[model samples]
Target: MTVTVESRPTGHPGYSQTLPREPESAAIARKLVRTALAAWYLEDLVEDAETVITELVSNAVDHARLESIRVVVTRPTEKLVRFGVVDRSRNVPYMRTDSNGDNTRGRGLLLVDALTDRWGTDRYRWGKQVWGEMKCD
Candidate 1:
């Protein structure tokens, strides 16, 4: 809910976007992230991070059926970037691998889980925060 545009650069490019939790919101958030961090150290990782953010936001939009999503990004250092998407969903997202090649829509988190250094979900009073971390040294 807060977007702090601080000057202290710790490789931390943070932005919080509250938007109607829809498919388009994911794309919006991705663009916002690229703009916010275009001057930071992880410019190369922006695309990957955007993809992850899109997947997380899209998941919430499609399955959670929520009204809004808030995204936050924090980079502790130049080598790591942690990001999360907050949504009004109580159900924790899980990865479902399709072995029979019959499922096409269940691989978002799987990609996130595979690409990130770590990823998890935390509970909030009205919803949950799904987060993941990427490294770019």
Candidate 2:
């Protein structure tokens, strides 16, 4: 996958990449997030951003019905960055409240909620985007 960092004349800079909807793609998505944060000089948010993107990408890989998924990292403001995953699935993700410590899965969104300042989903005509935002100093 060829990842590109984009700069807009009127808006914040962003980075985007399309990857196969597989578990391995989570690593690539983490790299993309790291690169974007580094370019924006928001290295302090790298760990949390990577975790959020990993969960988003993992959910898409497990539930989205497509061969590929798009990972987007955008700086919406000087002190805020958004991480999103776009996939061809209309089903919105919800945190699982029924999982115990013994469960090996279903804790992704819980972690996202704990780490991110805010998180939600955007529904489009073709698909949906799951996103989370973090604030930087």
Candidate 3:
């Protein structure tokens, strides 16, 4: 649970850390995000960011079928923040084609889709990265 918060010369702060594939990692990730947002003066986007982070991290921990996961939060630009969770599972995540009424297992992407300006997956030689980006005030 050692998280590093670093600031860039461009004035955008960044945070990075790795967490074990435990159920509690999601919550810990959220806390780390809140801290980063406060320092980066992006508190207005906390709620939306919180939801997005939870879904992204949980997917990596529970579904990616990996032992541990990596989390990165960075501001590629001042007005936007991008967060990604990298997992060893190469299976890219896709939203359910049909909303099975009351099915609680597959709605993570829906929240992500509604919350972020854009979200997608990228495949790497070892695994995949699930990322979401949103604009800040």
Q: lDDT by residue for model 2 over 78-104, one digit each (tens)? A: 667889999999999999988677986
lDDT of predicted model 1: 0.79
List residue ranges in candidate 1 displaced over 4 A. Answer: 1-8, 11-13
Q: Where does the lowest 10-residue lDDT sum fall in candidate 1?
A: 6-15
lDDT minimum window of 10 residues, candidate 3? 5-14
Q: Count the clashes in each prediction.
A: 0, 0, 0
- Per-residue lDDT value at 65 in model 1: 52
Per-model TM values vs. the true structure: 0.82, 0.89, 0.87
Q: Model 2, stretches more than 4 Å misplaced? A: 1-13
Better of 1 and 3 by TM-score: 3
List residue ranges in candidate 3 displaced over 4 A: 1-13
Q: In candidate 1, what are the lDDT values of residues 1-137, reduced to their tens digit?
A: 99986453655346677888778888788887786567564587787888888888878888775577888777767666777888887888888766638767778998789778999999877888899988766
What lDDT score goes with residue 48 in model 2?
83
- Order the candidate numbers by TM-score, best to worst: 2, 3, 1
- Judge candidate 1 at residue 126 and give its lDDT: 83
